[model samples]
Target: MRVGLTGGIASGKSTVSAILRDLGAVVVDADLIAREVVERGTPGLAAVVEAFGDQVLTPEGDLDRAALGAVVFADPDARRRLESIVHPLVHQRGAELEAAAPAGALVVHDIPLLAEGDRAGSFDEVVVVDVPTEVQVERMVRDRGWTREEAEARIAAQAGREERLAIATRVLDNTGTPEELRRAVEELHAELAARP
Candidate 1:
């Protein structure tokens, strides 16, 4: 089964992904691939440099994510330009990873922007780690040390909670404790594993 795992920022999506990984699912992480594709000598980085210029690069010539993020997040056109350059490469790499998994393996694609990109149809199952928007904001403030405004802006950038839930084949509500979330994931894993 190919599963798309997604949730809003600080919605415990990574925690669920990690649980799935530990439970023997082959995970293709999009965020990691995104970073790798833009690493110093790759064509992705070269493309980014050409699009946004060297100001987005660090003194050591690496992609300065924060600098680039500031530019793209603040401008809709710039965000699209950056996405146009990166999204294809991410999909290509993600496909390659999925194809390489063992036959009959449960392959999970952990993509933060799954809903935003309308990728639910590509997966056999879309598992959304659901949480309220206010809870997400609180988690970001407490866990990630972001201000309320910063957390809100980041949340606003992604698909809304209702939007994500709409695409979910299964919803794992993560509003409670870590133990509760873990138990829910284990049950989900068992359910998926039992599929024919």
Candidate 2:
């Protein structure tokens, strides 16, 4: 079975994904593949340079992620242009990994932008990890060191909770401890496993 695990910023999708991994599902992470595609000598980096110019690169010749982030997040056109270069490569790599998984294996694809990108219905099932907006802000402050404005900006950029839940086959409420969260994953894993 193929399921997509998604949520807004600071919604604990990675934490839930770790639990799912422990339960024996093959997890394909799009962000990880994105990094792979843009490694030092890859063609992806070349495309990024062509699109955004060498100013986005570091003195060490690798991608200066902070610099690139500042550019795109400030300009929608810049972000879209970069996404045009990166998303296709990321999706292609995802398909390759999905194809290579053992037959009938349960796979969890963790895509952070599934809803905003119009990909919510692409999976056999969609699992949303949710928490209160305030708690999400707190996490962004504590875990990610994001300023309040920065956190709010990212939240504003994503699909709203109602939109995400409207498409979900299952919802993982993540307003509890790690142990409680793991229990949720275990329960969901068992439920999916029980499905014929």
Candidate 3:
């Protein structure tokens, strides 16, 4: 099964992903693929430098993600440009990983932006880790060391909660304890594995 797991920033999606990993799902992480595609010597990095200029790279020639983030997150056109360069490469690598998974393996694509509509139809099932926006902001501030305002901005930049939920095949509410979340995931795993 090809599953897409997504949630807002700091929505504990990683925790669910880890649990799924432990349960033997072959997890293909989009974020890691994205970084790999744009690493120092890749074509993706070269394209980024061309589009965004050398200012987006560090002295050692690695992509300075923070510099790029500041540029994209503040300008919609710039963000689209950056996506134009990176998304195709990310998707390509993700496909390679998915193709290599064992037959009948549960391959989960942990995509933070799966609900952004660009990746529609990319999965057999879509599982959203649902949490309130305020909770997301609080968790981002507490866990990621972002200020509340910064957290809010990041949240606003992504697909809204309702938008994500509307397309979900399953919604895992994470407002409660960690144990509760784990239980929900375990149940979900059983349900998914039972599908022919």
Estimated TM-score for each candidate = 0.98, 0.95, 0.97
Which scores higher on lDDT, 1 or 2? 1
Candidate 1 lDDT for residue 152? 90
**Order of models, best lDDT first:** 1, 3, 2
Q: Give lDDT tens digits, candidate 3, residues 3-122.
A: 999999888899999999999999999899999999989999999999999999999999999999999888889988988888889888999999999999999999998888557476
lDDT of 3: 0.91
Give the higher-TM-score candidate: 2 or 3: 3
The TM-score that candidate 3 achieves is 0.97
The best candidate in terms of TM-score: 1
lDDT of 1 by residue, 41-160 (tens): 999999999999999999999999999989987887898899999999999999999999999999999999999896799899999999999999999999989999989988988899
Each candidate: what lDDT?
Answer: 0.94, 0.88, 0.91
Between candidates 1 and 2, name the one with more favorable TM-score: 1
Ten consecutive residues with minimal summed lDDT in candidate 2?
Answer: 113-122
Error of 1 at 15 (Å): 0.5
lDDT of 2 at 67: 92
The lDDT leader among the candidates is 1
| Higher-lDDT candidate of 2 and 3 | 3
**Compared with the true structure, what per-residue lDDT tens digits does model 2 show for residues 18-98?**
889889899999889889999888899999999989998999879989899889888878888988888889989998999
